[model samples]
Target: MTDPAIPLGEIVLPCLNEARALPWVLSRIPDGWRAVVVDNGSTDGSAGIARDLGARVVHEPRRGFGAACHAGLLAAEAEIVAFCDCDASLDPGAAERIAAPVRQGSADLVLARRRPTGRGAWPLHARAGNLALARMVRRRTGLGLRDLGPLRAARRRALLELGLTDRRSGYPLQMVVRAADAGWRVEETEVPYRPRTGRSKVTGTWRGTWQTVHDMRKVLR
Candidate 1:
């Protein structure tokens, strides 16, 4: 067990106009864990909210999901690094379970398989798109990952060595694909998924889901 006073790891949260959800998300971070909130040009004071809440805020001027994630990755200082959405759909507190395997040398990369906690928590189109993409990932990597969820953990140095290059929606999938190629012991566990606090920037509408699928397809190719 890690001492509550000692730092554990850093969790990167990519943000964009998520002020309302910031408080709830930040409060859930476990003791000794650092929160690096990557503000992706949020006009809703998300950056300030994060900073005031004791989360280190990294400003990524670029407006892509991958860009923001990469920025947070570069900013991370701990040996173990995790990533979660700032939308509050996923619990930041649950990162401990996801990260434990990596810290214990049991897994190289740990992903969260989301189990929706309520109706409308996950949109139908988004769910369908994710299923299709997961199938593609299985065929490409020979890995049986169920969900390409944002909540995940890995070693910071190894992740950097993957030399991830995607700066769009394909970033997450590219990480998994590259990890599999490198023979990393990628695994996953279930986490409850709740409805987000505000409008989703992606995977909330049919068009958004299609765009995400398209971006991920580029990685599969």
Candidate 2:
């Protein structure tokens, strides 16, 4: 049974110690859309802040990006499920535009192509890694995707049907690979990428970026 209170679409925010960014992130969610904040064992009071700001907080004890993302997906009841980082690196409001294609039955998956709005918004190492992955994706799937970005939207039922198994950094790549295999229509739109409020947990350091690339490469293989 669908809850009438539940909106037609919801955005899943995977949070890890993002208390400082919650207020801005939650406030920017499109009107009439629900925000599901999945707390991935944050030592900070991220969960409380999200709840206080009227976001539906789901606790994901597992400490991985995919784990938190999947937890939020499971907690969401909306027809459209969108994902955005809780770090405030990307605008949640852009979700409305990216999700429109899915809602209108024009695309099965929609990803945001991040165009950094500031000089330091995107780290050089992270960008290089992302570019390499995107090229690999194009070669493997022929999707013509420019970025394996965090801001994305898809139908909840269809996304679950993809049977995503990755519970780590490889999760997003796995989603695209599986979607390509399933012959799903994937689309991309440009969005402003801003500097995050707090230090990034992943892709903020050289080692972190390497680990992320390694995790994703395993999926590619």
Candidate 3:
């Protein structure tokens, strides 16, 4: 039930080799909201899947989460933008919950704090690292946010005004930090994190974790 007129918000799914999960992700978008998938150099036919399911597909061959997300943002024209991981880990059913605060004009930025429902949904070291980073973010920015979860929502214009430059794993952190610095009201909503359809891009291996940490350091510094 997509809106016939300009939509109030749009959900952006940053995808990479997620052909198997694209349908579920797009189906999770609530009625009346528009959906866009940023295909990140997927050789698995993810872009075609998105198109077949009635979602607008934007090609982003940069091969990074932030790069794909930034491309989606540029292509999105709604007043609000919500980002969801294309992998099945994060529930698409919670899109409305995550974007509610922003749509209601009560929050400038909202993060879907993950409540993992499966054992392997999150790795031990990754959880510890994320917690530590969350604390560091609290101390550094005074935003009081609890999670840097992949699922989040923001007012489109306000987000664009932040001038975020990170094109990797650090994009989320950069957005939150810069938004907080600019005095935007930031909030968190708990969303279930299930077992993902495929391996995580950032927490799947030692190399991935190190690269994420390195990129995050560049933003945090």
Best prediction by TM-score? 2
| Per-model TM-score on C-alpha atoms | 0.97, 0.98, 0.94
lDDT of 3 by residue, 146-210 (tens): 78978898878888888878888999889988988888898888989888898787878766776
Q: Model 1 misses residue 86 by how many Å?
A: 0.5
Clashes of 1: 0
Question: What is every candidate's alpha-carbon RMSD to the true fold?
Answer: 2.0, 1.2, 2.1
- For model 1, how does the per-residue alpha-carbon lDDT over 27-146 read when each residue is reduced to its tens digit? 999877999999999999999999999999999999999999999999888888999999999999988888999989999999999999998999899999999999999999999988
What is candidate 3's CA lDDT for residue 20?
Answer: 82
After aligning candidate 2 to the native by TM-score, how far in Å is the CA of 152 from where it should be?
0.4
Against the true structure, candidate 3 reaches a TM-score of 0.94
Q: What residue pairs are clashing in model 2?
A: none
User: Which 10 residues in a row give candidate 2 its minimum summed lDDT?
Assistant: 1-10
Position 176, candidate 2: lDDT = 96
